[model samples]
Target chain A: MKILLLAAPCLLALAVPLYNSDSPRLFGFPFFYWALIGLVPVSALFIYAVFKMDGGK
Target chain B: MIAHLNWTATLVFVAFFALVTGLGFIAGRWRAGDLDDLAEWGLGGRRFGAWVSWFLIGGDLYTAYTVIAVPAVVYAVGAYGMFAIPYTILIYPLLYLTFPRLWAVTRAKGYITAADYVDGRYGNRWLALAVALTGILATMPYIALQLVGMEKVISALGFEGGPWASHLPLTIAFIILAIYTYQSGLRAPAMIAFVKDIMIYIFVIAAVIVVPLKLGGYGAVFDAAGAALAKKAALSGKPAGLTLLPAQIMPFITLAIGSAMALFMYPHSMTGILAANSGTAIRKNAYMLPAYSLVLGFIAIMGYMALAAGIEVKNPQDVVPQLFLKMFPSWFAGFAFAGIAIGALVPAAVMSIGAANTFTRNVWKPFVDPGIGSKEEADLAKLMSLIVKVGALIVILVMPTTFALDLQLLGGVWMIQVFPAVVFGLFTRWFSGWALLAGWAIGMVVGTGLAAGPLAWTPVHAVFGLGFSAYNGLIAFVLNVAVAGALSALLPNTAPDATRAADYEDEALA
Candidate 1:
């Protein structure tokens, strides 16, 4: 389950074809740009969760 | 260029440079370990806690080159360049999974380098030599490129001199770096990274927030950048825009995944990982180090902001410096340049030390002189560190910068060839040393031949004349795995394994 959580972000971010569009802008950032940038923090949160599940060891 | 020198900025840059130099020297006594010991000098005595390891590894990996080059690529090529964003984000979870085991095993065996572990794991001195040589060879150009990054700032500062005298400031900065790294070892960079990172965060954050405001908003910036890029693509008959073209999707994904996998295999990165006191420290930093990636994301967008602000430069590499110059006040520009320049020092010192540790532990002690004692080994590492820095200095000063850039391209290709031997070996001893060495040879030959000869230094190559393309390193790395796996199946496992599975278990967890 923790592995799934960690792998989710990696898979989502690498599937570039899925988010390769420029529309649906947020704060002036294209969906393509903002989605990848947003993934940085989201990926961090997931990894942090996995770390916590590992007892933070 | 000469007339552009601002006294306010130069003074601030010099002041910050001096402050870091002083910090570099003073770091020798931090945590108060014996300077004569190899572990103390090379790996910070394996004593760095979670926070220090976070800063050190972050500073070491996301270097001055990344600061300058990522935005430069984005400025030149549009959305294709932000591959660095995903590449970086991919590595932390990778770290959470793979590197703690590496740390556990290396610490258990008192190994200072990946090559050292390779030697013990495969019991093949020849194979280990290949690993060490690849590291040193790849690192030589990398260290040179760090100077190239620093030179951009130094030249931007417009210190007055003829061609010969222009290098004076860079030379002096490096001399101080070499001396302190010799005296203090990894501790110098570990301590100074705090300053480097804080300065970077301040300048980059300010740029993202303030640059967009000055040029209307993020909307205006993206719109302007998109229009400009579309115009260029039409004029030049090239595929570049705010979004990736269908043909570009494969290259972008391959580049991101290929680079993320190869990043930790570098000797300098290994130095950072091995220096941590515990596996938990490494895993903890894995989740947090994405903060650097966040900063990198901001840095990549500065390219569009530069376009929107109407900053012009002949070299795209100069875009970031020119962007800061046009948008920020003179003093703040100086602070940013200082941040960028000192950014070079931390990595240069760490790279030289990593290459030196490889030479001393894997090459010199084993092959050159087996009788060398621990004290002598540490001394040799210190001296080799200076030599490596001087070699890099010569490469940057004497040769054309393009040569260093070319070799660095080949360096990445060369570096990933060692991955199967080191990382694969970390999990199982199923592969024999000879098979891995054979794979290494093929990968090196094919990767270098494609990069230097046929592909002419482009990272992507078409496979089998298909319409598809992929990163050359990834292509070569796939070939490497197939050969190694096949040969391992054929060859008997005669190479004696020096480590048991228990050695890779986290000591605290066990």
Candidate 2:
């Protein structure tokens, strides 16, 4: 479960830059407007899952 | 050539600087219990989580130097500059294995600085003293080079002064940085890193997507770069001439691998690692952080693309920013320049903080007074941190740009000397402290001699007759390891396995 959780953020990081052809705009800006838009939320979720297993930083 | 003064870009750059400076000052209070200890000031209360640590460490690692210079090399050297790509990629898996272990042990041992680890692990003040001196020495000029990167960006922004105009803003920038850093401590840089990273990602991604389109296609751009460098080599009289490839393939790999090994060992990287909250966070970052390198690879290619499109980067370091000016709309270019300009600031702050820690703890406490209070250490660290910034600014004004960059080459050669006593010391207790110091001293003398000698072709020149150059640091590392290993067998001494490693080796597997 812990290892599976770790793989999740990598999946999201891979997905955002590849699939968003419709220019998935953030805050009414261009698709490229927010670089970390996808990076942050996904990494956060993976970190949260890891925390449950190990307790915390 | 400095006349491309786009006020819009200048305005955006200054506005962002103001925003970054404000964050630095307030960060002194972040996660505050009390500002009474050096650890809190120097390492952000030593409790940074995944998020802050990610930005802080990333910001420290990926500087304006790499952002602009790597691409500039790609612009000039073809596949040669791509060395940065592989080096950055390979370094992560390496750091992931080593860094987490280092972080775990260091934290467990209550080691704030790498020298602190050297001191505790070997129980040899002389060995620890050699390591600490190397940290302070290596970091001073590395910090100076940060200001040099910012100045190149500033000059490309079209700012001009008298004969001295080139470095005046850099001096002012340091003064401003020093004040806020003194007020806030390491938290200042950590907090400011949020803004800096956002700006860099926007600029780098925008360049990767937008600029290539502006120049036609990636294929066409590479063809142009090839023609340009071939033309340059024709004039220079050397085959690998026009591009940064000066010598050949062997060197391309050496510079990359040598640099990668030395990267984490640099005091700045150690400082970045020390700021993380836990070993787990550092491990998590190890894989995730390679994402920055992905941006870096694309960023490096922009240099070749810019040269192909007839954009002349005034300073090679300003090549990426200048490319944005050539390709983008005025407003967008201003935004992009802000990213490069502000990007320089984050690393400068971190480098100054790292240098300050060396001066305060390694230089001051262990030598000046054997038993200083934590509050006094913190206070002195802040004071010295300011002085370190000032010292770097002086170097900024006086150094030739080429000389400033060469310092990194020397910095690499010098810092890697400490690996035996710091990194290897943890895994084994066999290497005697005296042997380690002897190895370190020899590496510095030989490396500095080769690097500083009069060899016209070499990056760091050479000492008198011995031919050495940019990659001399790697040579020094070899000599250091061999000497240390040989001497250890000759004189067996104490300093077996570390206390932190003992406690955690079982915890990790259990």
User: Any idea what lDDT model 2 has?
Assistant: 0.70
10 residues in a row with least lDDT, candidate 1 chain B:
B448-457
DockQ of 1: 0.82
lDDT of 1 at B455: 34
Residues B198-304, model 2: lDDT tens digits: 88888777777776677776656665776777876687765532233334444554666677777877777888887887777776676567668767766766777
Best candidate (score: DockQ): 1
Output the number of the lDDT-best candidate.
Answer: 1
Give candidate 2 regions above 4 Å deviation.
A1-57, B1-4, B164-166, B241-247, B456-470, B495-500, B504-510
TM-score of predicted structure 1:
0.98
Which one wins on TM-score?
1
DockQ of each: 0.82, 0.04
- Clashes found in each candidate (C-alpha, N, C closer than 3 A): 0, 6
Taking the tens digit of each residue's C-alpha lDDT, what string does model 1 give over B355-401? 99999999998898999988999999999999999999998889988
DockQ-based CAPRI category assigned to the predicted complex of candidate 1 = high
